[model samples]
Target: MLIILTMVLFALALSTIVMFISSLLSKKTIIDREKSSPFECGFDPKGSARLPFSLRFFLIAIIFLIFDVEITLLLPLVVVTKLTFIKTWVITGTFFLLILLAGLYHEWNQGALDWSS
Candidate 1:
């Protein structure tokens, strides 16, 4: 208990010292101007902030998120397979492949994957 307490205190002290030193060494520069505007595209700002975004952008974003999450789920399966001898990895891989293929087919059929449209 004493060792853990000592370690925690040491870590806290170390972190605080590092943070203080970093802040002290950092330059305090805040040059606020037109360049720091929200729309830094150089083009004149137009329309309201509540402008409706493209549905195609949302659709693509959703599809990308779905695939990203699928990849995240696969990472755990992959790590577990490396640690233990399990045939479940094969099943999971096949399931993921099938689902991905189906999603691709669906997207292709719906013309959502096509950018030229």
Candidate 2:
């Protein structure tokens, strides 16, 4: 129990010191106008909350989020491939890719991917 407590205290102190040093090194004293603004999506953070938003943008964001989540799921397959049978891994990876491709194709067909309109 004493050893465990000592190790925990050491870990806590080490983590706190590392965090403090990293924060000090990376601290941004000057805030730039572009940096302060919201990301590429043009809606101003301080603007009217009731302003109408583009549905096309919303759909694009949803699709991006769906694919982002799928990517996260797919990343684990690289690690799992070592533990699972080669045939099983291949089948799963192929099926997942096919589903992703089909969804992308459907969205493209629906004109959700078209920004020019």
Candidate 3:
């Protein structure tokens, strides 16, 4: 009990000290008109704020996100393959593959995977 209390107090003190040092070492910068101006692709300001963007950019981003999430879901299975539920894991993996292939086929049919004009 006493040891835990001491540890908590020590952690609090350490964090406070680190924060104080960081604050002292940091430089404060004032925001001016140029700094506050809207930035786009590192270029000068363009037309109105309601300017339209290419839908191809959005489609590519969404496809990348879908594949990214699929890879994330596959990582855990790779790590825990030695467990007792190997057959269950295999079935789950096959299901995931089927879903991924179906999505790929759909994208191909919709011309979403084509980069050439």
Task: Find the candidate with the highest lDDT and give its number.
Answer: 2
| True-vs-predicted CA distance for residue 10, candidate 3, Å | 28
Residues 19-106, candidate 2, lDDT per residue (tens digit)?
A: 9999888847556665777764687776777888899889989999999999998998888887876888879998999999999999
TM-score per candidate = 0.58, 0.58, 0.59
Per-residue lDDT of 6-62 in model 1, one digit per residue for the tens? 999999999999999999997666645444556722333555556666678778878
lDDT of each: 0.79, 0.89, 0.83
lDDT of 3 by residue, 43-100 (tens): 5585566667767767877998999999899888877776656888889988998999
Task: Report, for all candidates in order, the number of backbone clashes.
Answer: 0, 0, 0
The candidate 1 region of ten consecutive residues with least summed lDDT is: 40-49
Ranking of predictions according to lDDT: 2, 3, 1
Stretches of candidate 3 off by over 4 Å are 1-46
What does the lDDT come to for candidate 3? 0.83
Clash total of candidate 1: 0
* Candidate 3 TM-score, C-alpha based: 0.59
After superposition, the stretches of candidate 2 with alpha carbons farther than 4 Å from their true spots are 1-41, 44-47
